[model samples]
Target: MVTRVTNQGPLTGVRVIELAGIGPGPFASMMLADLGADVVRVDRPGGGGFGAFPGDLLNRNRRSIAVDLKQPEGRDLVLDLVAGADALVEGFRPGVTERLGLGPDDCLAANPKLVYGRMTGWGQDGPLAQRAGHDIDYLALTGALHGVGRAGERPVPPMNLLGDYGGGGMMLALGVVAALYAVRGGAPGQVVDAAIVDGVSVLATQIHALRGIGLWQDPRGVNLLDGGAPFYDTYECADGRYVAVGALEPQFYAELVRLTGFPPDGGDGPQDAGAAAGGEALDRDDPANWPALRAAWARLFRTRTR
Candidate 1:
């Protein structure tokens, strides 16, 4: 399995230091370790009192070191580790690392080639830089939450995957790798400011392109890819379960019609009583026709367990 294999290929000799936190930090470290980087997670004394199950895959492929940064001996030990390391990742809000005397400046002073990566919700400098926020807040600030859900419905959260993992953690890892490559030749000591808000905006690149075209609309549930296309959305199966429909293209639509045994010329289309009352075709684009189409599709699926 892709999840089980380690040391298979690539990133075999890379060294990375991860300052433990939550969400993005652990995810980023997991990716790095999966790709064969030797990642050492620096945890606080007594494991920071976080509740986590044993055998957590995120903490796998990594070694843990307990350190008390408040003490001079512990601080020296971390600096010593930095002296021979390639990169370091931290996910504290703005100035927390600097306050602990383990900031980029201090780490870079010890090892000039260190690629210091900082991950946070809001960035290193801004009005809300120091404020505590989570993934939903980050997505909200970046205009990502606005275009998320159905029309007239409340914005649905896409979990932490979008803001934390996609934007913050992945960006930090990429920045670290790029900086490491740059410093291998020259240009030592780089800092990567990876914020969840910034990363989410960067991820909106394709969405912006869709908006530039006439196909995308500002209103939610009216766009092609955002649950607006009736043919591309989920439908209720007869068992009260759900199945997705994706007859986007003509060929797929023909296949769907053939599979469902709908008439080729669109004749006798959807014999549902609701559609018969409306005198409409079972076309997905027509909202008034969806109820009928849904009923017909439900009847078809009811014969099968799925």
Candidate 2:
């Protein structure tokens, strides 16, 4: 068994053993360690599939120990460590830990008050739980990717932010904290099944609300919050740099219009918005005129330095 070290924070007294993996799992452990938990990462003999970089910021604020789980002694050593730990976080396939004899059952048996946190792409017991996936796959499956990008273009991948960190890691950290809190309140430690797919779906709660209210359309990049709105999207400046505009409110849009010196009410001169709608003026409120207004804004913004 490895020696324990005390840390300082809200979770100062908490102990966490992380079975080191990649991406979201490490990210979650980093958060726990940052919050004052004594997070000890268990790496394989060589490495944890990924090479170690001295500048790996994701694994900061944590200690690491290499253990050969294939060895009976090594497995026993981990179980011994689990006996004293407050939590164990693992991000493996559905049955990888079970096959290694360190599943939740094994850890919980060692410490009933232990919080067993599981991170995965799908979930613990879903149809695709055993399937291989990544952040992009989870985002695609959860309908999060479809809503991104321009109207006629393919969906733009938001890197791993949406699925790996935002959905998976953050959610896992939250669940672990909540579970640890429950243990402090005299509740038995439980497993936290944090799946990227599940979390991504939850992150789309507002999108779901928009859809239900009939304000959001099914197509991508055409909604008010999407790039469809002239005032809510980014524009290329004169210097070829892009500036993001999020003036969604009418007052903000009016201010934006005033500041840009683009003709007020979309005409050569200031005029009533209703009067300019029928003319060549770019009507900001009309969805049909979005392309035209966007063209106008693009032209206007291109004349200004970013």
Candidate 3:
């Protein structure tokens, strides 16, 4: 078995095998490597794609070995490494690993305690599991895309932050770690299918819960956290610079109103974070409420400097 020295950290003794792809594969392995796991990435023989660069921070903290998986000996070499690894991470689509002869069964047979982490856009089994997609497509499918941006305008993509990293690599890393813990508890290792759609959807649980309780709206950008509530939105100043406000609670909203010169009452010096943000904090029926307060704050902020 081959080994590499890693700096001391929480996972100092752990070993991981990473099958290189793009995006999430390097990202997840980076997390493991960052925590001092001896993560070795198996790259393809030719270095055409975004292979490791000296300045590539995500590809840092780990070493890589290249092998041609098209050859039987190359695949055997990876399975040999898997025998000594505690976990494995890959971001290929559904059956790509099976065709490469390095699927879950192949790796698990090499090491029963292996945490097989599969990262994908749709998931292992789904209607569109085999379909090609990117971060934008995953975010669009998960309802996260619609909740960002302004009300009337088209929803702007939040880039790859939400899907590719937040939902993809981050979730896969968390799943692998959690599965490794389960293995330590005498549980058999299993597949962690961390799909971008599933992870993004899980990240939107709060919005779903709030909507279920009538505290949120189904329409995009018209809710409290979305661009709906004026107190919780961004406004442009006279200098053309924008400032975001999230005075949701009564006390903080009171401070927001006071600072913006749109006091709910006529006289206002300065309201503290503990002061009233609104009537009963979240009283929708309060007279100095949204429609009027929103307009008031909009006008007040427009008059101020950046």
Q: Best candidate per TM-score, number?
A: 2
- Rank by TM-score, descending? 2, 1, 3
Report the lDDT tens digits of candidate 3 across residue range 236-272: 8889999898877866765665454454533233434
* Residue lDDT tens for model 2, 99-119: 899999989999999999999
**Candidate 1 local lDDT, 116-146, one digit each (tens):** 8888888889899989888899999898988
After the best TM-score superposition of candidate 2, give how far the Cα of residue 253 lies from its true spot, in angstroms: 1.9
TM-score of 2: 0.90
Models 1 onward score TM values of 0.86, 0.90, 0.85
At residue 52, give the lDDT of candidate 2. 58
Q: Give the higher-TM-score candidate: 2 or 3.
A: 2
**Models sorted by lDDT, best on top:** 2, 3, 1
**Model 1 TM-score (2 dp):** 0.86
Model 2 alpha-carbon miss at residue 94, Å? 0.5
Off by over 4 Å in 2: 1-7, 48-52, 267-283
Which whole-number lDDT from 0 to 100 does residue 261 have in model 3?
A: 41
Evaluated at residue 210, the lDDT of candidate 1 is 83
* TM-score-better candidate, 1 vs 3: 1
lDDT of 3: 0.81
